[model samples]
Target: MTARHVLLLGPLLMLLGAAYLLPFLGVMRWSVTLPEPGFGQYHAALSDPLVLGVIWRTVRICAVVTVIAVAAAYALTLIWVRGGRTARTLVELCIMIPFWISVLTRAFGWLALLSNKGIINGWLQSLGFLSEPLTLVRNEFGVVVGMVHFLIPFAAFPLATAMRSVDERVLLAARGMGASRTRIFWQIFLPMTKNGVLGAALLVFVFALGFFVTPAILGGGRSVMVAELIYLRIFQSPDWGLGAAISVILMVTVGLLLGVMMRQNRGAAR
Candidate 1:
């Protein structure tokens, strides 16, 4: 509140600006100024078929990953909320263990399981279940599996916070009135956690949009997404202007999603 307090915070504020804000502004500048300037890069990006395809694939994959992650997290949160202490501990460990693992490690683990010559296919072949291996890795299916595995924790913790806030007595009362178990879950229990579910879904979807490692590794360059595309443009192909423009588009998309999430959270508080 005092000038002394403001002075105390000044160094930290400057450090943050120098570290994050300046770099962000530089990226924004490169999008317009690089490759002979103007907004020509944006125009080319919008009209280019390859760019359009990559953007569409990224959005579609992220949507699928978000839906699956949120649903799976909701189930896991239910167990954590209602199960015994031992079960809660088990759930916590399951979620947190994967959360702490490196994304690259997890991607390789999935690759080992899903690849044609990998564990799953080999096991199936040995048992005579199939003459050939299923096409699992290096495609959209493999990318989805890896993304969902990585995102489940991001979706679960927020949902647990929401679910824990619900009044157990309300569910008990509904049960006392002879409400069917299905009815109670579908109508009462789920509605109580709706905001949390929405919040988790938005969080997962936004994170999925920027995902780079798992998609790149599992996809084997076959299932390219926006982040991977950005990398190829900047590093592999040396097209800084196009890469920066794509980065700007991704940043704007995330910003709009966060703005919507904030407005929804405020409305829910009311």
Candidate 2:
């Protein structure tokens, strides 16, 4: 509430507000009153079977990715917190490395690893385990794997920070009281970190919902996310109104989830 703080934040807030609101307003107008005008696009976007399927697929994939990423991150954070310095540093480096790498590069790396002539298939073939290459790339499995790899770091960093905030003395006291490790974890650790877990899950879910590059590269047209569909509608079909409608839907859905998360976080703090 200082004058200096207000002066610095005022212009920045204005710029951010304009940046978000302008395009959003444009999209909203197009969604409700474009092409023929007056809600036709929105109605079609809601009632069309293809659109509904794409939306459902996007939600389903995001849910699966969120579950896998959050579960893995929780276990990894526990290990990282308890690990030696060297091990924790190595894990941290592994997580950071992916974040710095380009999504296209990561997708290509996954293709190289999962393709028929890739290392995994070669190893299996060498071991006489399979007569043919397994289908890993260009499918739901590949999409999930690549998405999880990208999202795991986002999930881990937040949860790890939350875990570190927990008082070690509290855990020690639980142990001294003859509580089992599982009981201590369930009763103490999980409840304390619930907010962090919820926040990470929301973050990962939103990111996964809007994911385009990895799914496009790895899915190979087999798995179609809503983002990809929007891209196709705009650039391929040149149906700007339909594409705008889809974009509006995505923005609204993510915005509502974020609003709920913020409310829940505020309640937790109180």
User: Listing every candidate in turn, what is its Cα RMSD in Å to the true structure after a full C-alpha superposition?
Assistant: 1.5, 1.6
Q: How well is each residue in 1-270 modelled by candidate 1, as lDDT tens digits?
A: 999999999999999999978987998899999988799889978999999999999999999999999999999999988889999999989998996799999999999999999999999999999898999999999999999999999999879988998999999999999999899999999999999999999999999999999999999999999999999999989999999999999999999999988987887778
**Candidate 1 local distance difference test against the native:** 0.94
Quote each prediction's TM-score. 0.96, 0.94
Candidate 2's TM-score: 0.94
Report how far off residue 111 is in candidate 1 (Å): 0.7
lDDT per model, in order? 0.94, 0.90
| Candidate 2 per-residue lDDT over residues 32-146, each given as its tens digit | 7668778788889999999999899889999999999999988888778878998888877877788789888999899899988998999999999999999998888899999
Worst 10 residues of 1 by lDDT: 261-270
lDDT of 2: 0.90
Q: Ten consecutive residues with minimal summed lDDT in candidate 2?
A: 30-39
